[model samples]
Target: MAPPVSESPPVETLDLWLLEAAMELPTPLHMLVEPNPHIALNMADDPRLSREELCERLSLLAERGLIRVHALPDGLQELFSPEEISSAIDARQSRTPFGYSLTDAGGAIWEHHARPDWSRFVNAGQEPSADEAQDAWVIEAASLEAADAEFHFHESLGDVHQPVGESKHGEVLTPWQVTYWKTLPHGYRLRYVTVPRPADPARSRSVPSRPPWYTRVWL
Candidate 1:
């Protein structure tokens, strides 16, 4: 028998554009679907929809709990910033298009069922107050080794890199990472951690990105 659909909360609803965006995501990394091809097949170089439409689509996606959107990280932006028009074109061509990712519930719904009014899937989670948000243990790179000791890999939503049975520290840090780290000047090394957001565990918020469960790489 098919498993029953999980109950959805009041907040988990999706409009058509939001549904399309969720479906189009290649992975849970904010993939830029702004010039959504499906919406405008050969429509134009720019978004066929007006700015209001685009903004509304993005807003509805977030408000309905299908995806999380945030400003591009400054460091990452600088790394990708183009030096010239040609460079800009090259960077855009090569870059992993990033923008928004489906929440846990969004993933499940996307995989198991036809597109739904995603807002229907909201979790009846209590909104965390300033105090609770303050108290949440956001891990820092320096503390990764210590934190790994306390939580089993599966216990915490945040442990993105630690894997099972790969090493004493239990992460399958990729082979390239060793050479990459060695090349860096002394006193710096790669740190594996999740992007911190205030957790609204009950409802859909950005779930932490992790390496594939089958093979792990520390980011």
Candidate 2:
């Protein structure tokens, strides 16, 4: 018997392009928000980056399913919100918040992308301009090496720990971080990476955002 024709649609060309864009920005914001968005995205120090630079990186994040451009307030009802998308501004005036970060879907992406070290940050500033969320990813990746030693000392560790997006509802798989954690008790870890293949295309980590720990090749 022959293999059945797969119904899965071909990967959206635009999505692939966007993923590439996300990789390019690799701004490094995840470190701030991962454990808690309000505390990180809102409270951290501050820095600056240009719109052109941000737009390019954000484009990739959008493609990676990390973030979306649809305009709507946050809430379950908003998921289905409807609006007219004009080519002129892409509805900029109405956009809920025109910026960058992992979309609600990013929860799952973090699930997959995160390792025990996903929570750390490097020399990143507390605050960043334009794509604040995008920049977090980089800080989050770099801090891994540094935080591993001092994190346990923090008060936050004493409480029942859980990832920012996770809830009592249990493990959730979201589009933002397409990857899920492999180990539960051991802290965030990668669930899978395009499974190993002989000379398969390497795993693509957003540049600068991924950091040095992800040294393995072939995604």
lDDT of each: 0.33, 0.29
Candidate 2, 1-219: lDDT as tens digits: 112322233433333323322331322323212344323433222222233433444454455455654333322221111121112124344434332333434434333333223334222212233543322111112223443333322212322221222111112223223122121222221111111123312222221223443211112
Show where candidate 2 strays beyond 4 Å.
1-7, 20-69, 72-83, 87-90, 95-124, 127-219
Clashes of each: 11, 39
lDDT (10s digit) by residue, model 1, range 1-219: 223334454323333324434443322222233346443422212334554444565555455555554322212331111122113222334434334445555544443444333211111111233553222222111133433533333234432222232222222223211111111111111222222355445433334543221111111
C-alpha lDDT (0 to 100) for residue 102 of candidate 1 = 52
Model 1 scores worst on lDDT over the 10 consecutive residues at 176-185
Question: What TM-score do all the candidates reach, one by one?
Answer: 0.27, 0.27
